[model samples]
Target: GAGVSQSPSNKVTEKGKDVELRCDPISGHTALYWYRQSLGQGLEFLIYFQGNSAPDKSGLPSDRFSAERTGGSVSTLTIQRTQQEDSAVYLCASSRFLSQETQYFGPGTRLLVL
Candidate 1:
């Protein structure tokens, strides 16, 4: 089966413009995660969805950031107003089980706001 993948491997946009990044996880995966990583920085968890559990959005930086998973497979992260500070690699991961499961990561969607 296919592993996780993200679209627009790289993105460049002006401040205030909106952008949407997509992620496709492996089939049969029940847990999905979204994270952001600044250049040379570690990953920062954004949101996570597992089966019927309530999606965790605690790590979302601001109101401008949001995400949703459809049919527990593909997910999308949307930024309402692009900012220079938002420039980073957005990574997506998926796992079979929620606990102690190592999530597989995508190449990530790199965003650059100028």
Candidate 2:
């Protein structure tokens, strides 16, 4: 199967707008994750979804950030009332079973909040 794919590879929005980023995981992958990387910073875990279990969203930076995975395959991350500090590369990754397994990552969506 194909690797993970994300829509809108690049986005530029106003400071007060909202944005939706989408991710399509590889087939049969039961674990998915979202991460953010700022300039000169390491990847920051944003959310995690595994099988039918509840998603671990503790990594979300604030109340305006949220995500959801459907059927254990596709996931979407939404950021409301974007700010300049929110500019970063949003990355999505998936694995066959668990977080400890080999994970495949997608080309991140670069978001620039003006």
Candidate 3:
């Protein structure tokens, strides 16, 4: 797809399980970011991958949350030992560069941990 795309638009998992969410950003976009939106938190940044530089993971809530982008194109966010609090909409976005004014956002993946 030409635009950013995410797999498994909806995911339901039990607490203590692990889940991997995927994202495919627009071609040639050099900056990619992961975010989570929940009831308490409107929107929070999770991770950011820009080009070959080390990803900025300061936004991650804990060690259980991790993400990686390969070939500067596809990225994956993995949550290990998921908890009920981990349930939220995982969003992916990409831009030609971090300085770009406009970012392309994917249809987020809704995760429900029971």
Q: Which lDDT values do the candidates have, in the order given? A: 0.89, 0.90, 0.90
Cα miss at 62, model 3 (Å)? 0.4
lDDT of candidate 2 over 57-100, digit per residue (tens): 78999999988887777889999999999999999998998857
Clashing pairs in 2: none
Candidate 3: count the clashes. 0
- lDDT-wise, the better of 1 and 3 is 3
Residues 60-89 of candidate 3 have per-residue lDDT tens digits of 999999888889889999999999999999
Error of 2 at 68 (Å): 0.5
Runs of candidate 1 with Cα error greater than 4 angstroms are 52-54
Candidate with more favorable, higher TM-score: 1 or 3: 1
Superposed on all Cα atoms, model 2 deviates from the true structure by an RMSD in Å of 1.2
Over all chains combined, what TM-score does candidate 2 have? 0.94
Candidate 3, residue 51: lDDT: 75
**Backbone clash pairs in model 2 (N, Cα, C under 3 Å; residues 3+ apart or in different chains), count:** 0
Stretch of 10 with least lDDT, candidate 3: 48-57
